[model samples]
Target chain A: MIVATSGLTKRFGRVTAVRDVTLEVPRGVRFGLLGPNGSGKTTLVRMLLGLVHATSGSIEVLGEPMPRRARVVLPRVGALVEGPAAWGHLSGRANLRLLDAAGPGRSRHRRKRVDAVLEQVGLGGIDRRPVRAYSLGMRQRLGIAAALLREPELLLLDEPTNGLDPRGIQEMRALLTSLNEAGTTVVLSSHLLTEVEALCTHVGVMDAGRLALDSELAALRTPTGRVLVRTPEPDAVVGLLDGQVVDRRGDTVTVRGVEPATLNARLVAGGVRVTGLSEERRTLEQVVLELTGSGTDRVDRSPHGRRPEGPR
Target chain B: MIGVELRLMLRRRRVWLCWVLLCTLPTLVAILLATTRLAPPPGRGGAFLSAVTSNGQIFPAAALALVIPIFLPITVAIVAGDTVAGEASAGTLRYLLVRPVGRVRLLLAKLISVAAFVLLAVLFVTLVSYVVGVAAFGFGPDASLGGTGAIPSLSGVELTPVDVVARTATTVGYLALCMLALGAVGLFFSTLTDSPLAATLGVLAFVVASAALQPLDAASAIEPYLPTSHWLAWIDLFRDPILWTNVRGGALVQLGYVVVAFGAAWANFSTKDVTT
Candidate 1:
């Protein structure tokens, strides 16, 4: 594992920011931490970097016990937390140079690495401009460049696409994919389900400071082999199929446990004309909502004999 | 890294502005004293050097005293206040912390930079004043200290221009110690607060409170212990019969404050969870 946390915990006064979060990030994998706002993603990342002390539990990054020996470990790790925080008065190149000076790179190697990272992040042309003048997307890229300066083995990025436009997001995804392909493990926190789905190999869903689910993207998106049918008569088909009703709109019925062939045959045999029939594969977003219990509330319970689990 | 920090300092326009003001203040004062005809006492030339150099000691020290209450604290505030919180605000704190450098070394680098600025400011004040004072008043030996109390009076020592410059340099060294204590205090407050304004104000408030407490004659026994009280002890060098005891005591007190203030700053900065 490139990064591992066992029973990792953090608290601010009386409020626990992260509670018993246990996760393992394999090397060269793009892992996504999916959560809503204030769901402890930032806190967990801080603990892993030793930026904040963990209240309890253990964190190991690159095989080194966190925080206690992070000084020895951090050189191999890179991170961008929250937003880009560079000196507004200094140029982007100067900002990188200052951070680079503090890293383990030699003087000649420092300049070369800074130049390479700047070019890699598409910031080569604007390195001379003061950071205050850079746009939000540009700033974010500069931040990534700073993080990549040392070619760290593990990169922990928090909301790397927070304010990016579509093109910027695409660029970031490409950059991350390339980094991962080159054998760098990446742990990215984002609320954008599409981004996570498109980029992450594994995902961890967090809700209210606790891990709701953790697994590979493929497993989380395992095919349900069910199709949703929208018919004018949901009540008529209820008795005709052996599937459970997941949701019901004015004329749409989302059914589970029934294959598309069986559902189509049953609906036609019952003299019901299917207006809309489409296969539904579990999206990471849907899986997240289901695991976190948001999907349970909107699910229809009448005539299905399935009771929603009580709140945890 | 400190070398990089120094480059950052040099590139800042504010530092240049500070340099201008520092160089100009003493020269202006020297010109004003020379152009204005103050009635001379018994020994004319000796009286002139005494008055000007005495003023040199107190005036520059006073300038440093005032500058520190406002500018030095702000300088320290600008750098130290931004150390962690500013980085946090900029979203670079984590980036920097994740580098190989230890937090202790980073903090030490910043502290050293602030110390360099304080020393530079002190040296500027001393050199500028000495150069302008010597140019305005004729270069002569300090008068022998035959008259005033245990405070040795410089009445007959035919000190040349070089001797006067050397004496001024010595006084500046003493004054540097005092300003360094103030700088360290400013750094301590800066480390404690996130807002630069708050840190600057807090250090000033402490200085003001200490100064207010220093004048209570009833508290004379404790007055010497306060950092502000010994600020003027550099004047002992100008006295007819120099009082080494007061100077020595003042130096010790200043040193003690520097150690304590820096120690507190180091402890707080190293341990605080930097969340911005």
Candidate 2:
């Protein structure tokens, strides 16, 4: 794993920001940290970056224990924590050069690297513009460019698409996808499910300072071999159904592990009024709602894809 | 890197303004004194006024002494207070710390950069004073600021012109070191807050308080150790056989401050959570 945390926890006064979050992100994959506002995502990311001291437990980045060894591990890991913090007085190129000079290792080809990263992030022509004049999207791109200055093997971005328009978000998605494709491990946090759904290969859901769910994106999206049916008199329809996932929510009844036609026929035979039938693809967003809606006190996942089989 | 910090320091318009202001003050005073027949009053400005009329060569030394009470220290204070807090307020300190370099190195680089600024500010003040002083009044071998009462002296030191110039250089160097302690105070406050103005005012407040307490007989016991207490003690350097007592004491006290303040700054910064 490129990043691993075991029983990690953080608390501010009486509030716990993260609780027993044993997360692991394998190398060479795009991992998305999904959470609602105030959920432990930023706190977790800060702890991993050594900006916040963890209350208990352990964290290791690139196989090195953090933050005891952050100085050694962090240089190899690139990050844009929270929002883009650009110096208003300096041009984008000057900002990158100064930040690079302050980096842990000597950058031998800084001029070339600065130009290349600027071009890579699509800010080449605007390198000379003072950061204060740059648009919000432009500043965010510069922040990403700064993170990529070292060509780090792992990148951690917190809400990297913030203040970005749709076109800018697409560009950011493309940049992160390409970085991951080229063997860079990425873990980005966002409260927007669509952003994560469109980019990530894996997803971790946090809710009110707890890890509500952790699973492969593919698994999270896969059907739990279930179908949902909305019908009146669900309790009476349950006796007519052979499927075990006969859950009644409000006036609707969902029957899992049974063909929709078979379940529909049975409900009809029992003189039950069936109004709805739909396949449950169980996208990660749905899983998020299911998990956080249940509570912020425990971890949960889709039953069909709870554990990824075989080698990671 | 220290070079980058230094560049950033030199790039600010306020820095240039401070230096430019320092350079022109002595020039204005020298020009005004040389072109006029009005002698300054008998007590405070008398020594510099009397000496500057005939030999303006003493203008730089006298200007330095005049400004030492406030101007030069204020310039240093502004720069020093801005060191860490300036970057913090700008939201740049977090990015710098996230880089591979440690906080200790960053703090050291900041202190060094400010120290260099103090050196440059003092140099500009004195150099400009010398040029303007020599222009307004003729340059020549100078009499001592000793027994003649051009300035009061603790000892009657008969000195050659070359020795006088050398002693002036030593006095300037010692004053620069004392400013380091003042700057260190600014640096420490800088790490505690993000407002550059707050830090600058903090150092100025220290200077004002220290000076305010200096004349109090009741506080005299505690006053001598204040950073500003022995600032003018360099006057004794001009005495016959050069009185070293107060000069040595002043520099040592400043050194003690530098050690304590810098040590505290480093300790606080290294473990500081970079929330900004």
Candidate 3:
């Protein structure tokens, strides 16, 4: 695991931002932290990077316990915590120079590295422009350039596309995807579900300062393969299905391990008029709503019913 | 790391503007004093004119005295105040902390950057003063500048130009240390909030309040510890037999403030949560 947090918690005064949340990110995986506003996504990212101290729990990054080992571990990790915070007065290249100089990489080809990263982030020829003049997207890109300075093993970005345009988000998404493919462990927090869906291999959903859902995107997106059959004669529909049929509703029945064609044939043979039949496939959005609750505004009961069981 | 930080500090337009202003003050003062006689009515510029006319080499020393009270302090205050809180306000502190750089190292870099700024400001001021002072008045054979109206302790003593230069260097050095103390205070306030303006005003307000309150009898006991209490102690260096009492005490006091203020700043900043 690139990162492992067990029962991590953070509290500000009476408010607990992250509570008893445990998560693990495997090596070279694009891990996405998805949550609504104030759901402790940023707070969790901060704790992992050792920017904010956890109230309780252990955080191990790259097998080193942090923040006690933060100074040594940070050199191998790059993060853009809140946003792209660069010196407004300095040019993009100049700001990165300061960061690279202070970075632990200490590569002698500093200028070459900076130039390469700037170009990598699409900030090539315009690196001389002062950060104050750059658009928000450009500043965000430059921040990523700084994060990419060391070619770190792990990248922790908090809402990297927070204020970005569509094209900027696309570029950032593609860049992060490529980085992860190249063996860098990427952990990003974002509210945009599509962004997470497009970029992440694994996801952890935070609800009210707790990890409400943790699973692979493929697993979350997996189709149930069960077919839904609706009819007026509920008692007759049970005999029409060969597999164990369960009532999906008063008139509908759900059958497992039976194809839609087989069920339709059986229903026709049984002389039951099938009004409607469809496969059961739930989108990640539905799963999120179901796990978090229809109204996450109030502290509702822990509806861990749908939280998938088994090891990730 | 420090080299890069100092380079960034030197590249800022604001820092350049301050340098221009500091250089201009001594240049204008030297020209106005050198070209014209020192026979102005004795209210505001009288003491400086007397000191300069008595010995032109004393122009640099006198000029520092005239401006150290407000101009130099404000300059140093702005730099120190901008160092920490400015990054926080601009949202850059979070980025800096995520690198290999430790919080202590980052704060130390800021301290060095501001210290470099203080050094440059003092050196530039003194350099401009010296060039102008020499051009306006010859460099050699300056009479003893001590025990005049400002001191009246060791008058009529002749001194070579070397001693004058040495004393001026010491004076500048002392003023720089004093400014470092002031910078440390500004740095402390900078760590408290994210607004650089608030930090700057906070520093200025504290110094102004200290000076403003030093006059009351009730505040007399705390006067010695004030940042500006021994500001003019460099003047005593002009005495033939230098008075080390106030100068040493002032240096010690400034050092004490430096230690305490920087300790407080590091303590607060190291553990600070970079919300911005």
Candidate 4:
């Protein structure tokens, strides 16, 4: 595993920001941590990077104890916690240089590495404008460039696609995908479900400071023992399948406990014209919503509503 | 980490502005003294003001006197207080920490940077005031006194130019140490809060309280222990015999402050959760 945390918990005074989160990310996987705002995703990410010490439990990144061996391990781990931050008064390139110099690295390759990362992030032509003057999208790109400075073995990014337009997001996704393909373990935390669903090979959902669900994306998306059939003669198909049809909308009929091939062969034999046929599977959104509660940002006036479970 | 810290400090326009304003104050004072031909009477104005009109070379001493009380402390406090808190507020502290800059190393770098700033500020003030002083008031009646031209010590005895330069260098080093003690206090307060302004104010309040209690008979029991009580002790360096009594005592006190304040800062910062 590139990153492992067993029973990791963090508390800030009266509030428990992260609660007994035991997460494991195997090597060379694009892992997406999905959660709503205030669900402890950022706090968990901070702990993993050793920016926030855990009140209890332990963390190991790159197979060495975090923060204890942080000096040796962190140089190999790249991260963007909360968001991208740099000295506003300095140009982006100068900021990168200073950040690189602050860490453990050979100075001779500093310029070459910085230029390579800037080019990778599509900011190679960026001029000497202070970071404060860059557009939000430009700053976001610069933040990514800072993370990629040392060509880390593991990349932990929090909301990496924030402030990005559709094109920018697409480019970021492509960049992450290519990096993962090149044997870099990538872990990104974001509240955007679609973003996670599109990029991650493994997904972990956080809700109210608890890990609600953790599983491989392929396992969580197994076929639901149902097949969706579309036919102009819905009534005929329903008649042919009988009680097997559980739902119908327009020309589409949902058939349960039946293989798509069996149903298709039966339909054709029964002279029912089938236009589209496929097995049904649960979408990641459905699995996530079922495991996690509503987002924490919503507040209701009534006090009788069901409170989220855990130590208050 | 120290190199990066110094580069960051040097790149800041605010640091440069502080140094300029520090140098400017003494230059302005020189202009006023020259234009009016009125130097405050002996023992009445700044420590060496009266002597400055006679030997322009002594104006650096008067300039140091002019800024030691308030201007210098305020600038030092601002820079030191902003050391950690500024980065926290700007959201770069976490990045630096995750850059794996050890907490202790970063603190050490910041303290060194603050010391560098104080030294630079003092050096600029001394250099600028010397130039202004020589331009406004000539090299004094001693310039024609041949190769062994002598300047008067505070004790009214003649001293060679070498002695004057040595004493001035000692004074500069002493004053820098004093300001570093104050900067250490600012650094401690900086670790206590994420607000740079609050840390700066905390440092200023500390100095004010120390100054306020310095001369009070009621506080006399603790007077020797106060940070500001020994600030003026550097003046002893200008005496012909070079009184090392107060200067030694003051250096010890400042060293104590640096140790204790820096200890507190490291204790608080090492385990900080860095939520910001």
Candidate 5:
């Protein structure tokens, strides 16, 4: 494992920002930390980076005890905390140079390294404007560039795609994917399910400061032991299935207690036109919603505690 | 890390502006004094102001007196207070910490930067005032005949040019130590909060409280211990034989403040969970 925390917990006064979260990330996987807003994702990420000391438990990164050996381990790690931050008066390139100089990077290649990371993050032609003048997307890119300055073996990003446009997000995904392909371990925290779905090989869901779920994408998206059939003759298909249809919406029927192949053969044998038939599997959204609670952003006063549910 | 911090400090427009403003105050005073030819009556205005009209070489000491009470401390407090708190509010502290800039190392760098700003501001003020004083008043009568002028000490005796330079250099070092003590206080308050403004205000409040309590007969029991009480002791550097008593006491007091304040800062900062 590249990053491991056993029973890690953090408290801020009366609030327990992170509960006993024992998480592990292997050496070459894209791990997406999923959570609602204010569900301790940022706190946990800070703890991992040793910016926020844990109240209890232990953390190990790069096979060394965290914070104690942080000096040794963190040099090989890159991170973008809650958001991008730079000396507003300095240009993005200057900010990168200073941050690099503050650490243990070789000074001989500092200029070339900064330029390369800027190019990698699609800011190759950036001018000498101070970071304060950059748009939000530009700042986000600069933050990513700072994280990549040392060509770290592990990349820990929190909301890295925030303030980014669709194209920027796509580019970031490609960048992260390529970096991971080159033997880097990438762990990013975000609430965007589709982003996680498209990029991460493994996912962890956090709810109310607790690690509610930790599983591989494939494992969590396991078949629900049902088949989804789409046909123009929905009524005919339902009739032939003999009440095995658990749900019906227009031309589609969810059939249980049957395999896709058996269901398709039965449908054709019953003279029902089957336009589409496939096994039902849970999407990342469904899995997350099932594992986590309501969005912490919402405050409801209803006595019955009923919330307008689904994704926040 | 210290080098980077110093570079950042030197590059900041605010630091340079503070330096300019510090030097400008004394230059304006020199202009007003030179134009009017009416110095404040003896012992009535800033410490050496009454003596400045007769000797340009003495203006540096007078200039130091003019700014030491308010300008120097205020600017030092502002810069020092901004050290860690400014980075925290700007959201850069976390990044630096994660860069593996050791907590102790970063704090040391910040303290050194604050000290550097103090030295820079004090040196600029001294240099600018020296030039302004010479242009406005000319060298004293003794030096006008191409002879080395003698500057009167705080006592009645005369100080040769070499003595004047040596005393002024000593005054510079002493004042730097005093301001560094205040900077250490700023560093401590900076670690206590994330707002640089709050930290600066806290440092100012500390100074105000010290100054307020210094002259009160009821507070005399602790007067010798107050940080601001001995700040003027640098004036004793110009005494004929050099009054080392208060100067020595002031150095010790300021050194004590530096040790305690920096210790508190390091203790609080090293373990701080930098959520910002």
Candidate 6:
């Protein structure tokens, strides 16, 4: 494993941000951490980078215990957290140079590496422009360029696609894919389930300061072919069918643990008039929502139960 | 890296304006005094240098004094205040921290860059004052005492114009060191606070409070040791009989301040979590 957390916990005053979360990310794997706002994704990333102190438990990065000698270990890791930050007055290239001067690369290699990373991030020719003039997406790209300048073995990106348009997002996805193909381990935290599903080989879902689930993407997405059928006679179909009703809304029934053919056959045999029968292959988004106990209908329930479905 | 930092500091129009105002204030006072008339045997020229030196050394030195508590310290505070906090505010500190560089090295670089600004601002003020003084008054070496009210005739010294400029430069150097102590304090406060305004005002408050406390008879013994008290020691340079005792004390106090402030700044910065 390239990154592993065992019983990791963090608290702030009266609130817990992360609690007893255990996760293992393998080398050269693109791992995704999925959660909503305030779900402790940012807090966990900060702890992993040694920026925030872990309240309890241990974190090992690249097989070395974190924070004990983070200075030595961090050099091999690159990251883009929150947003891009550089001196507004300085040109983008100058900002890169300043960081390059302090990075692990030698002075002789600095310029070449900076140029290459800038190109890799699709920011090659505009290095002379002042950062103040750069757009939000451009600034984000510049930040990714800075992170890649050292050719680090591990890359940790938090919302790296933020501010990117559809095309920019595609380019960034391609860049990350290429980087991963080059054997670099990647750990990215994002709320974009589609993006994570496209890029990551493994996934971890977080909820209420705990790891709800962590598994390989393939295993977590085990091909459970299921479908939902909407009809006026759900009870009649249920009586005639061997399929399980995973969910029911009025007369509509969401049936699972059966193939589409078997489900359609049962519904028809029961003399039920089906208004809709759509096959539902589990999307990473649904799996994430289910694992985190944040299903579309269930997520609105308050912890105190004063209101079953309070305002989100 | 320092060059990049300096460029960013100078790029702000406000920094340039502050630099100009600091450098020209003494000269402006000298010109005003030179154009005006004065009483009896002393005449306008005598009164001008006297007023200019007193006001120059005091107000400009007070201005120079203000550098620690007011300008340079605030500038240092603005720069150092932003070092981590600004980056945090902008969401960049985390990006920088995750780089291969050690936290200590990053902070040391920032401190050195801020220190360079302190030195440059002090030098700018001194250089402009010297040019303006020579232009307003003829290039002559004259000395006057601040509190004693004694004036030394320039005729006896027989010093050349070059020697006068050299002496003024030395005086400015000493004053710069004294003010740098305050800059260090500002830098320390900058590390402690996330808001630039808070860090800048915090140093100003320290200066104002220290100066206010200096006049109390009850606190007389400790007042001389305060940073504000030593601010006027630069006037001792103009005294007919130079006081090395006060100069030494000022230098030592300034040194002690620099050590403590910088030590505190470094300690706080290195351990601080860069989580905005």
How high is each candidate's TM-score?
0.83, 0.84, 0.86, 0.95, 0.96, 0.83
> Candidate 2 lDDT, tens digit per residue, A207-297?
7777878788988777767888787667777777755755778866767778878877877878988778877787776788888743343
Ranking by lDDT: 5, 4, 2, 3, 1, 6
Two-chain DockQ for each candidate model: 0.59, 0.55, 0.63, 0.80, 0.84, 0.53
Better of 2 and 5 by lDDT: 5
Q: Output the better candidate (3/5) by lDDT.
A: 5
Candidate-wise lDDT, in order: 0.73, 0.81, 0.81, 0.91, 0.92, 0.72
lDDT by residue (tens digit), candidate 4, A1-312: 999999998888888878999999999999999987888999998988888899999999999998799999888988888889999999999999999999887898888888899999999998899999998888899889988988899999999999999999999999999999999999999988899999999999998888988889999998999999988999998888898889999999999998888888898999989899998999988888888766667754456677543322
| Number of colliding residue pairs in model 2 | 3
Model 3: DockQ against the native? 0.63
Standalone chain B TM-score for every prediction: 0.76, 0.91, 0.90, 0.98, 0.98, 0.77
lDDT by residue (B1-276, candidate 3, tens digit) is 677678878888999899889888877877776678553453455244565655566677767876787888888888989988998888777777778678888778888888888878888888888778767865434233343222222343564566767877898788889998889999999999999998899989988997897777898889898878888888788777888899999999999998999999999988876677
Candidate 5 lDDT tens digits, A261-291 = 8877888899998888888999999999888
* CAPRI rating of model 4: medium
Cα RMSD for predicted model 1:
6.8
- What is the per-residue lDDT of model 3 for residues A33-113, given as tens digits with 9 covering 90 to 100? 888777888889888888888889999999999999988888899888878888888889888888888756655988998
Q: For residues B70-113, could you state the per-residue lDDT of candidate 4 as single tens digits?
A: 99999998999999999999999999998889999999999999
Task: Quote the true-contact fraction of every model.
Answer: 0.72, 0.56, 0.74, 0.86, 0.89, 0.68
Lowest lDDT 10-mer window, candidate 6 chain A? A293-302
Worst 10 residues of 4 chain B by lDDT: B142-151
Fnat of candidate 3 is 0.74
Error of 1 at A286 (Å): 2.0
Over 4 Å off in model 4, which ranges?
Answer: A231-259, A265-273, A302-312, B144-149
Between prediction 4 and prediction 6, the one with superior TM-score is: 4
On DockQ, the stronger of 3 and 4 is 4
